[model samples]
Target: MAARKKWYSQGLRFSCTGCGYCCSGRPGYVYVNDEEIAQISQYLGLETAEFLSRFTRETHRERSLNERPNGDCVFLDPISRSCRIYPLRPRQCRTFPFWNSNLRRPRDWEDVCRTCPGCGKGPVFSYETIEELRRVIDL
Candidate 1:
């Protein structure tokens, strides 16, 4: 019989280095569900409707946070490279590189790690832990 492979059998570690590399570069959507929008709105002390209108935009049937003209996220502070709503950031933002797409293959993760200093460099996550984080991605 062969031993089964665990989710992160190779062992993965990650910690944000605060370089803000993930928050900028290339235009992308940060999808936020209604509950997330409400949390963020409460964090910012705004009503749900106001927060949605002021900080997000609709695309087809989905809603995502707006971005600066240069592609940086609206919540990212350019000068300090810090998220204004760090605690209440969207689910996608909270999950970081743990998204299934990046974890699907070793090469894919390496590709993402190239610029993200935090990807391969911090606390090692157990398979269970990694799976939990992956599960919440876009949820």
Candidate 2:
């Protein structure tokens, strides 16, 4: 008997090598939602309002996570090359190259892929995971 092909085998694949390159330097906007904000605040042991005031900035009327003066994410631990708030990270961070709503064209992903070696190659995610991301981001 032949095994059924995975959804990823039809199309789409990505594996995060955990290089941390994508989490470094001023790359692009990292949008956050209210629920995510609350989760991160709780994770940091801070009040939701306090966390937002301390770690986020308003841009174009939207709240975005703050970046360090050197351009890295505020939550990025330089020594570990990992996100201190990984578990509570926002949906934007959760959904990367698979941001279907923002990925209207291949060019939209070029810059991201250029900075992230993990892009365009890696693990094959199930369609369920992709759909979950879409739901999380309201895409």
Candidate 3:
């Protein structure tokens, strides 16, 4: 049997402020599967091959969106602080603070919140809502 999940009794609240903090200040993998890459490529009006060559790097044999040397995600708009291809962004980008890792412990959530002003603010989400995001289903 699987271990039960630890849930936040207080529920959770968050809203993206378009601050770009999530897209900036860290070199981390934005892991993307083929379906996501195709979606993003179509959104950007690029051929899949061109998109793969320009926007991603091979990460342990899987593809992940590359970040600039300064740590900003390649699609993070310098002026607007918005994702360039918001609608077709990878599932990893859509999940945000609702990921299973972030929801596992109170301190884990707080730890992530330090870098993300959006993590603990704005509209509250019920347990079910958060669970949906964590499951990587429709957002």
Best by TM-score: 1
Model 2: per-residue Cα lDDT over 32-122, one tens digit each:
8778888899899999889989999887757889988778888899898899998877877777767765345557556567777877787
Question: What is the descending TM-score order?
Answer: 1, 3, 2
Per-prediction TM-score, please?
0.90, 0.76, 0.89
lDDT against true structure, model 3:
0.85
Residue 67's C-alpha lDDT in candidate 2? 88
Off by over 4 Å in 3: 1-5, 137-139
* TM-score, cand. 2 vs. native: 0.76
Q: Name every residue pair that clashes in candidate 3.
A: none
Worst 10 residues of 3 by lDDT: 2-11
lDDT of 1 by residue, 1-139 (tens): 9987854676698998888887888988889898999889999999998998899999765898999999999999999999999988888888888888888778878988998989889889777777888899643
User: Model 3 RMSD to the real structure?
Assistant: 2.9
